[model samples]
Target chain A: MFRHIVLLAWVAEATEEQKAAVEAGLKELPGVIPELLRYEIGPDAGVSPGNFDFAVVADFASVEDYMVYRDHPTHLGVIADVIRPILANRVAAQYSF
Target chain B: MFRHIVLLAWVAEATEEQKAAVEAGLKELPGVIPELLRYEIGPDAGVSPGNFDFAVVADFASVEDYMVYRDHPTHLGVIADVIRPILANRVAAQYSF
Candidate 1:
């Protein structure tokens, strides 16, 4: 499987409503996008004092399938409409496992 | 379950051997640590530009179990000995799912 993981840190001024919108937007993806085999998104658990605020872990059968998720209109809409406004930093990693 | 994901970006001067050693050290954790339910580590696949260099995804049954792995001597040793030396930046996220 190809795994794609993204860690996001929100800007200091980001509101709780904005973060919720981000989560709500993401939760809608797996149902709409068939190539997404596994989709998991969560807020940081606060076990660590300093850590990224959110995480996204998605799986695909192949890199091509992942590209489908990447370019899908729903996913792009979420990024452009909600996530980018509050996104302070992002760290992503993709690999075959 | 609780998930912990860490993204690492090494300095420009970091050597391949050093990165390999980091992987080698992490591979030993699941064998020695009972609390680590699932562990997946991989170098970035290069699909995205300017992504983090590597990722470590770990799962635990509960937050307490994750704490065990987090504080494990072997894991600490790796952070202190191998990873911390050449590390440029790190982003981590812990969550419950």
Candidate 2:
């Protein structure tokens, strides 16, 4: 399986509602996107401090499937409308296991 | 369970031998540390370009178990003797799921 992990830091001024909207947007994708095998998103529990505020871990059957999810209109719309507006920093990693 | 994720970037000068050693060292822990419920580590597939080079996803029964792994002598030794020497940047996040 291909694992795509994204760590996101929201801007300091971002409201709780905005963050919730982003998480909610992410939670909606697996149900609608066929290429997404599994999706998980959540807030950092602060057990390991001084890092990004939110994280997403998704699985795909292959890199091509991951790309389909990546460029899908629904995913792109969430990135543009909900995420990009409040995103401060992002670091991503993809690997097969 | 508590999931602890760590993303690492080896210094540009780090050699392949050093990277391999780091991964090998990480792989040893699950056998020795009972607190580590699961561990997965790998180099980035480069599909999500322009980010850290490696990532680690580990799971524990609770935050307390994670702390035990975090501060374990063997783990600390690996960090100091292997990882920290070649490390460039790191971003970490922990959450319960």
Candidate 3:
């Protein structure tokens, strides 16, 4: 199995209302992307010492499957219309097991 | 190799000043924790639709190493002192290859 994990940080100054709106937009993505085998998103717990604000974890059968999800048009639309506006920075890592 | 990935989301209402302070506390962890083989933390890009704010990716020789890092005292101090206060929610995943 291959996992594509993304860590995202948002502009900490965003209001609660803005956060909720952005979260709602994000919640709409899983159904639109067929390649996603398992997808999850949520806020950080008090576990690590970092400025990160949110995270996305998705599982794919392989790297190629992950790439398809990464490049999907609907996925791109979400990035442009919703994610980009509120985010301050982001990072990703892919691993296989 | 085993990978420990953590997805963190912070309270959206945090200020820029608060974000910086939290980040500084996080940046101090690597040196204190010896088991972390490859640790990378960053904000999310506008790639995926999600309200998440931060991400952490760490590689270990094995799952045991990851557990050690997870339960370490210095690590917990950072969590309690810096991470818990700012975060809203969190998730984690472990994989091997």
Candidate 4:
């Protein structure tokens, strides 16, 4: 099994409208792919002292399954229309067990 | 080896003062414990379209090592003075291979 964590940071002054649009875009992802075993996203709370804006956690059966999700049209569309516009930086890490 | 991911979300409107204080607390963590193999903290970008604010990724040689970090006095002090007051939500997951 493979576990992937994708970390995202947005501009500090991002507007409410932009944050809403971003959340809407994310909600549309699960329906676009079957490879996601577990997917979750939420805002960072007081757990760590950092500047990150958001996070997504996903689990796939294998790297191949993850690849399918990565290439899906809906995923790409979000990147183009939603994610890239507001994001300042991103980090991703994948591991297998 | 064990990989642990801690997901944190803060109030979107967290003040600059709060953010700075939190970051200071996190910066002081590594010196208090030697078991942390790899510790990285950052904000989430626009990768997955979720609301998480920040994330910390750490690797430990064993679960016991993680426990040491968890129980360290300095770590606990930070949680009380820096983390608990400013954080709204937090999530953590652990896996071994």
In lDDT terms, which candidate is top?
1
Scored by DockQ, the top model is 1
Model 1 alpha-carbon drift over 4 Å, by segment: none
Tens digits of per-residue lDDT for model 3, B1-97: 6666766677978766766666676667788877888776655543446535666777789767888988988788878977788889775655554
Q: How well is candidate 4 docked (DockQ)?
A: 0.05
- In model 3, the runs with Cα more than 4 Å from the true position are A1-69, A72-97
Which runs in model 4 stand beyond 4 Å of their true positions? B1-97
Residue A88 local lDDT, model 1: 97
**Native contacts retained per candidate?**
0.84, 0.69, 0.00, 0.00
Give, for candidate 1 chain A, the lowest lDDT window spanning 10 residues: A41-50
Using Cα atoms, each model's DockQ against the true complex is 0.87, 0.77, 0.06, 0.05
RMSD of each: 0.9, 1.1, 11.2, 11.7
Error of 3 at A51 (Å): 21
Give the range where candidate 2 chain B is weakest over 10 consecutive residues by summed lDDT: B46-55
Model 3 C-alpha lDDT per residue in residues A29-74, reported as the tens digit of each score? 6788767887766665434465366667777887788889888887
**Model 2, C-alpha of A42: deviation from truth (Å):** 0.3
Candidate 2 lDDT, A41-97, residue by residue in tens: 799997655978998888899999999988899999999999999999999899888
* Clashes (N, CA, C under 3 Å) per candidate: 0, 0, 29, 26
Per TM-score, the best of the predicted structures is 1
lDDT of candidate 1 over B23-67, digit per residue (tens): 999999999998988899988999899999989999999999998
Give Cα distance to truth, residue A89, candidate 3, Å: 23
Candidate 4 TM-score over all chains jointly: 0.53
